[model samples]
Target: MSSPTSSRAVPPSSPPSTQAQPAGLWPGLGLSAVAALIALGINHAVPTASALLVAIVMGVILTNVRPLPASTAPGLAVAGKRLLRIGIVLLGLQLSLGDILGLGWGMIGVVIAVVVGGLLVTEFVGRLLGVRPAQRSLIGAGFSICGAAAVAGVEGVIEDKHEEDVVTALALVVLFGTLMIPLVPLASTALGMDPRDSGLWAGLSIHEVAQVVAAAGIIGPSALKVGVIVKLARVLMLAPVMVWFGLQLRRRGGQVEGKRPPLVPLFVAGFLAAALLRTTGWLPASVLDPIKMLQTFLLAAAMFALGTGVTASRLKNVGGRPVVLAAVTTLAVAGIAWSGVMFIG
Candidate 1:
């Protein structure tokens, strides 16, 4: 009996992560700068256009390589997206909770009105369009509630929706939201809205915080505070609505064996944890800035991934139902947001 001789040859090259050096700081910063620059160019209505625009540019680069089918992509991208939502929520820390609470509470009635009204109106249109009820419900969650976060949360708990429907719902939220960034201010001025009222309306109505900032910035600084507070209040609604929609999706046969995941508010809890960390002075101001910067970096990376993910053909086929749902729902929400600000303030 003899020991077997070794046959394998060692490779000389470093592994991919090491060989590439993890994309480097400059590449990431360059990506962020490009996003910010593009957003700045398109930011007639808003501040964070950089996120989406940057993502699109990256997406163009990504698609050129012929991506793994989204089904085959690693689970981390999905998780990365959730982390971005948490980052957005935690940005609330830059404000005094007292001020946001003070202003935001008044908008609760309006928030409720917007959330409910938008959903019902959109559902009617989705129903008429013959979209599946469960799928339509997810779209309603986004428009009536918190945009992508709302859509993602409701989707987490509902197994019935086609991935296409989920993608389309998310697309409609971002697509219409980005469009509204510039146009909302123009409409606000055309309607001769008072600055405070317009800010409140823009904050309450716009889909993303970045978009709200852009919309309010177009009005003035006075509106920035009002609008950001309004949007943060709206963001808070992601939890309860996600839970309710989760139950509805289950009732509607959306629940399958091990299909439902926890709702989006769980991530909100992580957001609150970060805020509590800040308030407790557990995180120093010096550290806080970096942590926020980290979150922004993470968000930018994810946005780049999102932009890379979509194909123009896919975007074109996102369906008429969700777009119409978004418009009608926006109208319903805006009207209620106005009424709520008027009544509460």
Candidate 2:
């Protein structure tokens, strides 16, 4: 004979305690950490292979080969979200305003144009091919900005993004960016371009920072310096672009679960603050070096977490449209960048 209100009330013991949350996260986090360490080892052995790429690929392979335990979910979520955001913030430390501004106004304009133009062209082509809006946006962001990192950043803002879209976008970044590593240097030699021009082209057109570095390294030290700086300039655009995405989602009345995304996500703000800190020359190389290593490991771990979501079955359903879109955008950006290089000269 309990009262109606008392009968309806749930017992306190039924709800999981907040204290248990940290313990629950450890299993998955440990798995991701192990995978990231393995990826680092592989990258150390093969200097040409990117640790992020290696980590993601390993995650994909491991998950597809056999499903992960349910216990890993919480940790994986933290890796994908929190670790990824922190890594992105640390990424800003690598960029210096002085180095980018040194490229001159014309080069700066080219960098902006490439990011904007590439995004537009990718969206147009994606629409023509009947690609889904979310997937297309992800692909466009990845190619136009900084590859997989851009893709991950955009995914955080978009309320309706699927894990499949992220996996597809990342795969495209790896496939097309890798192809450009050798092709760009060979093309530079064939065109008889100087190191500076070649570096500009690589920095502007290549999808990933690592790929640009590899390409520029093939040309010479001067090219490597210019290429890295130009690539960082593109990385700087991630903040504004992510903000734009969040605003667009707001306009559409999109919310994740019941919560609307912020106009500027906390992580994006952190990224900007880190960049300004780097620009101030407050941090010495000794401090920056360890931060860089930590950033890389965090990013690699997050990529591995994201990669676990990719399965062969899901990828098969993605079709060939995205592939065509990637190829078209790759050429489009490369052509636009080359034209800018010639004009600036």
Give me the candidate number with maximum TM-score.
2
Q: Encode model 1's per-residue lDDT on 158-182: one tens digit a residue.
A: 5555545655666677777778788
lDDT of each: 0.60, 0.85
Every model: Cα RMSD to truth: 8.8, 6.7
Count of clashes, each model: 6, 0
Q: What is the TM-score of each candidate against the true structure?
A: 0.73, 0.92
Tell me the lDDT of candidate 1: 0.60
Candidate 1: list runs displaced more than 4 Å.
Answer: 1-48, 64-72, 75-96, 249-265, 275-284
lDDT winner: 2
Provide the lDDT at 315 for model 1.
53
